[model samples]
Target chain A: MIIPALIGSLPRPVSLSKKLEQYYLGRLSEEKLEEAYREHTRRAFENLRRAGIRVITDGLYRWDDIFNPLIRFIDGVEVNGLFKFYENNFFYRSPVVKGELSLGENPIPEWLNVALEIKEEVYPGAVLKAVLPGPVTLAYHSINEAYESLDELAEAYAGVLAELMKELPVELVELQEPALAAELSRATREKSDSVSAETAKALIERLEKVKALWVVTYFGTPRGFPEGVILNFDLVEGTLPENYRGDLGVGIVNARETKMERRDRLVDKLKPLLRKHGKLYVTPNTLLDFLPESVAWRKLKLLGKLGGE
Target chain B: MELQILPTSIIGSYPKPRWLLRMYSLYELGRLPEEDFREAVKDASVAVLREHERAGVDIPWDGEMGRSEMTEYFTAKISGFKFYGPVRVWGNAYFNKAAAVSKLEYSEPLVLDEFRWIKANTTREIVKVPITGPYTIAEWSFNEYYSSKEELAFELARILNREFTLLEKEGATFIQIDEPAMLNHPDEVPIAVEAINRAVKGVNVKFGLHVCYSNYNLLADYFDEINVSQFALEFANRGFREMEFLKKLTHGELGFGAVDVHNPRIETPEEVAKAIRKVMKYIEPERLYVNPDCGLKLLDRSIAYQKLVNMVKGVEIIRKELAKEGKESIPFRRSA
Candidate 1:
């Protein structure tokens, strides 16, 4: 019996005050944020190690915004003002892509560099994983007020992200393509939804350039997957809804409400699903919010036991 | 019809009922107690609705008393889809890829059933019946049945239309359709607006649209699309940046969120009065209704009550101010 492994990227919360101060002070001397990020990355690895998770990530500990942190590394992107997502109280700022996209000498964010360093330092033998926003998801989430078309912008982003992927030295890279699954309301989809297909194709092509890719879809159904755009990805991950029969990374534990029985049932549900798929990987519903240490441990134990048995 | 004003607002109901937390399994056969659950519905309705009336609210909702969960409640009632589980918020939207617990087959409209239950139990004339609109329901859930979200939304609208018609026939005077999803998918505004219009077609009742925590920049243009008599939005809690756009976009009545519902701290009457004053610049005092920023379901009972008291006091002060200035004042009254 091949049991699924538990793996996830845990991002550390950065205080808004500290992030602003760092941004305004022009303090790029020794990568101060990157140094602070290393400590958090160490703590995350230690936590995952204690929980017995075999496949670990730096938990994206160094970055302030998940997607925008890469702007510093990318050559043509200009940082803009901040915007708040009122529902969740998360903040994001836009980055303007300038003319003639050229790959930065370094593709990984300074935070990810610290994460990679921490992984080498802390868990020399364990697998190191890195995550980046999918080029398509990033393009969609970004404010395109300056860009003429999302398709044009997405193509540029794809090239940059693909080049960046080659530079990062990690076993696996998860490209979380959340926007691909977004259902454009009928009104807008009728006019602009066609761009999504091209965006999806461009993104998949970009990820194909990167090795050991996991194309993760979340937030919507996989109903309208673009036709004839097979990129031979190593893995696809998402919390399958209850009625879906497609391949899924079954999420049993409610990230909001932690219940042991719920977690067990989630594992039970995954057993059959995993049997069908050769190797399974389990991830919680989301990573932004903290899952209690106990729940994380239980999931890790379940995955480890499956692997061992 | 005489308007009755009540004093009490929100009471705490935490550790949500056990059935609500069970995902779509709550509606599974033999999983939940049918009669006992229905009784609990009645009890919840009486408890919250009566409490609001006693507390002097102009209109009272059962506090979403009949629903299991906010977004997932539609899965059990809508056809061609299944409940995946709770949706997790991602970049700008919510994502749920969980498999369906079971295929959805709606024999009757659940919202109608719940509305009837509430109407049968309550004596208040203007019991606010809250429904999750098509755009919100589709946006919040995992889309499985239709190839496109628009199709799924229209289907939801048809079901809601049935429920709205039923409620109208059953003497429901006020219906509030909640559409928080509009904030995330601004492109869905027109689709949502059209769906709502279709749902409430031929219904001779006061229709209110509730959108919370959205950037008013996108919502400024919403009035042109939606056919609602009133737009009840979060303004006081969100601040006054939206009022300018609201003044330009809205031609109908507005419900100014005067109290913060998510925050635990209670506002003073003076603070509430100040917030209302800011809103009055854009909206006429007669066209403005004072309420909490969002639903009080998340707040503790004491804080909710205190907020309501302050909100009502603020409205009274505003009314007095308008009267002294020779401006027409609309008295706050509850449904008779």
Candidate 2:
């Protein structure tokens, strides 16, 4: 079976973006802002239905970045300064771990409930999936003032995320682990590699206790992922490991650039992989929010074509 | 051209008047005529230039009123670039990002017309021209066509070199290449330095490198290797923290940031003087230029004007102290 899905996040429409800004500046009421979020969430699902995506999300319209929802709702976490999201032009507020980490009153369950209601209304048969920052990526992207080492930080993150995942209504989830493939300096890379692997192993053990998950890596080389774990590789900047054997995510569509991908050429390239792997997922190389709304829409149309619908 | 000790200036952008912003929107939506929009831009530029002069700025340009952004404005003029749509840089702000579709070429003179207009309008003998640097353009744009980022940057450098030569030929004295995107990738510092050197190659004029909101430690090692006359850095936002980094920058003049442009509270001259005093221990007064941390485009016009006022008044305090030692002025060198 071939699945068509997005990595996570869709660019909010300019109108919703304006409303968000107004809400931030206290010019708009929270009730009015919630109306905008609901309206935009409905619009996002409608767009996904138009693109014929089966496995979809609620567009993560409220998330400024991958770390946003976690940093806001998790205990022992404080928002720190902005750090560049890898080498891309975008930035995210770094989470500073202050004390023992644990899941507090998370908004994901409510968010997922809203998404499930929208899915049933907009596209009844669609499978709604949740996405989160993997422990390894979260650990490295943060400032570790409290944890003795990054391994301990990531282990704590894994435990907190596992507890959060159990509360989510969705069965399938994606843990974005870009740090596994991130390009770092020689010294930092060496230090992070072992910690990243250990963190990934710990996360796999914890999440497996709840439900199956997909590990998505982008923007750099893909490695260190355990076998039998479903994986996604950003083929735009990375190559799939030849020795890996599992359900594969072929990320052929370029998300960072505005240029369109050739649909026929990509379909032909994935044919061989589809024959070898029983389950294959087609996705964008990175988050679609990197592109403009118009461009991202066109890319989704292309993704629909690749779904062979 | 001669400059007084601690010559005060801005890092290019000033807040656009609200009326001008409205007109700019109308022009974008095709509600206003192009000729009328051009006239409004001229009026705004003159308005900002006069504002800087009133604030006691010694060296003022047109405040970059003719352009909306640093990278987008330059890439829009250069050949072989295509804009898809706007992308978010941060909260509520978006820039029209472009992708390089082919080899970059110098189709027309970028920023030359702006420089010419400002040169004719400003009373100052020497006006500072800020152009977006090549490495910044390459780093910010989507590189679908280039084999590597370094190649694209070098191609951009070759194109910018032509623009610099044209500006120099047209009698622009000082040109500051703004590369706020440089330190984002510390490993790319070598490429950035090489690209900068190539961009200013054979252009015999004073050039300043302006970078803000970045870790200066990345460039501290290659400060002298970059072929520019001045290094305009941001300090006020960080509370002038890490003043020790100035010791590593052995060459080039320093555009000392004394007023925090990111903050709305108008800094008192005493506070600015104290900040300047801390850096004066490392750099001579004649080699240090005082300015706001970065562009004042984000602040309201009234607040921006007051900040510059305080910045100049702060420099005046230091100037009096230097005058006692007979070191109140220095000749502006064309190149390092």
Top TM-score: which candidate number? 2
Lowest summed lDDT across 10 adjacent residues in model 2 chain B is found at: B87-96
DockQ of candidate 1 is: 0.05
- What interface RMSD do all candidates show, one decimal each? 10.0, 4.1
Candidate 2 CAPRI level = acceptable
**lDDT (Cα, tens digit) per residue for candidate 1, span B239-299:** 4444667766446667778777656788888887888778777876656666677777555
Top candidate by DockQ: 2
Across A189-292, the per-residue lDDT of candidate 2 in tens digits comes to 12332464656676665776676788788977766765555788988889888777877887888988887989888888788787777678888888887888
A158, model 1: CA deviation in Å?
23
User: How many angstroms is residue B202 displaced in model 1 relative to the true structure, after the best TM-score fit?
Assistant: 2.2
What is the per-residue lDDT of model 2 for residues B1-336, given as tens digits with 9 covering 90 to 100? 678988898899999998999998999999999999999999999999989998999889877888988889989999899888888765456788889998788999998889888889888888899998988999889888998989999999999999999999999889999988888777898999999999999999999999876667777888779899889998887667767778877768899888877678999999999999999898877678888888898787899999999889988998898899998798898665
- In the range A1-309, model 1's lDDT, one tens digit per residue, is 333333344433333224434555575434555555555667767766665566666665444555656766666676654344322323455565665456666536454566767767776656776777767766665545445787776777778777887777775776666556652322111224234675676567556656666555544454334332221111223334345433334333333323334446555665675666545555544443333334445655554544432
Model 2 residue B66 CA deviation (Å) reads 1.8
